[model samples]
Target: PTLRTSLPSSSPSLSPTSIPSSSPIYISRSNPTIRKPTLAPVQILYDVTSPKDDIKIYFGKDDNDGREGPPKPHEVATNVLDNSGKKYLNYNDLGSGFTVEVLDKCVIKGARFYPANDREGRDPSSYKIEGGRRRKNGRWRWSTIKSGTIRLPAARIKVTEPKLDPRFPHAEILFENQREFQMYRVTFPTLKDSDSEHSMQIAEVELLGYFTGGGVSLEGVRTTPISSSSLIAESSNPVSQKKRFKSTGTDRAENLQHSFEEKGPNYLLDLTTQYDMVGILKMNGVFKPDHPRYKKLTDKTGAGFISRVKNDALVIKPAIGKTVIRGARFYTSDSEEKYDPSSFVIDGGVEEANGEITWRRIRAGVLNMPSARVDRKTQNIDPELHPHDGVWFNNDEVYDMYRMTFPETKDNSVNYEMRISEIELVGYRSTRKLEESNFNIYDLITTIYFWRYEGSLTVPPCSENVQWRIFDRPIRISPRQQATLEWLIRAYRDPDTCQRATVGRPRRDGTGNVDVVRPTQAIKYDHLQVHCTSANY
Candidate 1:
């Protein structure tokens, strides 16, 4: 390599180039006119054309030109096209041409000298010293020579694996690069502050240097592709700790500790004293019909109907084994006034009490009968306070409740419970054998007994469990009251368009979905108590 200076000149015969003698070096470039391709290990490409402005090349090993000055354009160009030099390419081999500038050089020819100018004979600024006069010895004359430097930019090296994919070479210029039609410059001041440093002595800085798809080896070589296995290798020490579960000791904790409930309350089920049965009789005002499930809720008539009554009624018979409470009877008692228990009327439908209510073991012989009463008030049998409001149901304004219906007693609006007799459906008052097919007075008497055991008041939070007292007697219901209940079940028409309310399932109402009843809750235990306060005369 040689350090070259220049003599400046201007002539029309030579190509006019704006490249400065102090131009950046492009160590790599290729003669596109030839097919002798250059590789990264041989050359580096650079931009030297100064048509627009100065091209900034940074300082680094890639641009390290050991010559006393920056690499010249000819050297840069020759290096790219040359096959005799080292395989390591310079800027010219990379295909980016270098810029060449013409410089002025002094020539000492015997006493008389000629001006060193371009072929056009024009003197560049360098050829004319700032204040030199024309009287100098001819031997000291200077002339301009075509002088320029080549720039070699930093480049990436890679183990080109084009065989992997000929279309996408393993190592080549990356697509969408800043090097593509973009200006890359290198500027570094290796000495003192800007103005104090010698232009040729500063160490260069790096602007761009890369090797495609390679890792930097400890030996200062980037030659490996990143892979998943090596990336997931963890350090020797544990990276994280596992979490443990927490245990809470409270109500449930205590309960869990208790293995079992050995023994406690033993109920001597006195089926005869079942208060729910009495309450049902009083509510329905009559007997309940027969049912198949016996104790379970089912489609059986005796298991479903309910009742309640007003001051003008009395229970005649609650069905018993289909025998109308089997000789069921009611007597009136007016402790404050003169009253005959037998004379107290029972709507003339109830048969005289033959036997009492009883409970028999599942397999014990024949079942025996025991007396039935409302808190031992069998003698107090009389009219109820709230009679049916003309419908088959009695409205309990205070409780906001209604005993939907009853069956056996040929009654309506009476008891909420079914007599044990209702359950067995063994005995029932003949009542002229009145049935659903007939609206005869018998039909008006006893109603089915059971209740859904739910809440009342078709309103919110509908809290329940109020004791319903329906009479085992059946009474005629006015047609108007039945109509009221019917309205509640079906949809009402919009009076304007006369659009009937779409009943059935909710939503179809043209409004939204809604449930007429509440869902049931699981029950583990229940409690009850009956207090008979002596009535004031």
Candidate 2:
């Protein structure tokens, strides 16, 4: 029986010119080096495919580093080329395999494949050809282009009386629109004869198309290499919290300086004095059993005192760059009864050139303790919930801290309450050298000794992974702001219940000003260091 058709039969014996150099070009979608239509024949060696086959082989390179030349079809399978023995890349147990990015946009007319000589149950019978366009960021976004099956005969020499053995070496798979595209990906969804266990192997693959920019003669077609290192880095740390800051400019520094001078240095308070008061009490009334972790509390105060209240341990996530910060919460010590939530102004600015930094007030608000602990608290804290969250400074040279004051309820009250409010701090440096510098917040701003140490999270599950930062300077807030904070703390209700919790307990004396903070612990063997900074002028 003789088979005849309008389409010409493809054979390995025919000259490469027999196939039109323009319509169907022999291209290794895997390799970007060879762009011509004609390809030198390569052989495939027989071997079992492994699950760990590097998909990068399809890109025409031998390894991830591209140190070695492209693999010969017979030497080993770097990608899914099906030409020779021991050189075929395999699909995993699931028949899905690899994809390759093309160098330029082309109008793909059809495709051809040269199966390996030892093809048995391992040939791909049906599969999909996908195409993609390159985005501005140099990534190819892919979509399915065509779907078809292997219609050409297997690689076998035919037997005819006059030595008419038609070489069944190439399978011609046609495409729909000759659409232009920059990327192509192939996937073998199924195998021949309902066999799922065998992996697909192809010795040589060819795509028939012309460049879309002009024509076949167009020179200097641009190509972008898919960076392997960037892909690896992204996969390793997807959501890194470390932030860095950059300097802005120095023009606004003078106006800010004038504003600070008018306010005066008395506006700032040193919170270390409050800690000294706790030292005098010998931590008698500080430890409360009703705290989140009652067993962790100790009699000591200042540094090492662990209490049941989760807030005692110094835990913070630093936002160094343009990080957005949401809201804030307040906590108090057990001995502090006159303390109330405080209101203050928040200023944000960028560091500028020549030691001149400019700042402007961004937010004016108050911070309050939560009325409902269980209903408001979440197991995992997301630091990005606020709007002002990200890195603000280019480096760690000059940093900003929020200062708050809790004034006692009385006329002309000299006795006041103070503590550092927890911030959604991120990008904190674990190790750094410190030196005193003439960096001033304002003429009104006072420079104070700041300490950095490790503490536990002051909440339930009391995790001891907090790095605490305490600044010596505290900003001033008016009495009216303090009163507003008191009302908010006492009146604020649990969103879930729509009602405020009872405040008549022993520690909470219905004044709406209870100690929400973790009791100060004594500094044991941990080494402590103080650092200071001021304007360079």
TM-score of each: 0.12, 0.25
Candidate 2 residue 39 C-alpha distance from true site, Å: 30
Q: Candidate 1 residues 36-87, lDDT tens each?
A: 1111111111211212222222222222322223344432232211212211
lDDT of 2 by residue, 1-537 (tens): 011112223443222112211111111212312223332221111111122222343322222222333334543443233222233535341244455544334445566555554544556677677777778999878777777777435653221212111133567665445345555676666556424333455554555543332111111221111111111101001122111112225533333233223322222111111101121101122322223222111111111122222112221112222222222223223323333233332333343444332332222222333222211122212222211111111112222322122222211145343332222221222223386988875634434555567666665555666777776665444333454565565566778998875342224343335443566765656534445445312
Worst 10 residues of 2 by lDDT: 229-238
Candidate 1 colliding pairs, count: 150
Superposed on all Cα atoms, model 1 deviates from the true structure by an RMSD in Å of 51.6
Write down the TM-score for model 2. Answer: 0.25
Off by over 4 Å in 2: 1-87, 91-93, 135-139, 156-168, 193-196, 214-537
Full-model lDDT, candidate 1? 0.21
| Residue 33 miss distance in model 1 (angstroms) | 88
Model 2 steric clash total? 79
| Native-referenced Cα lDDT, model 2 | 0.34
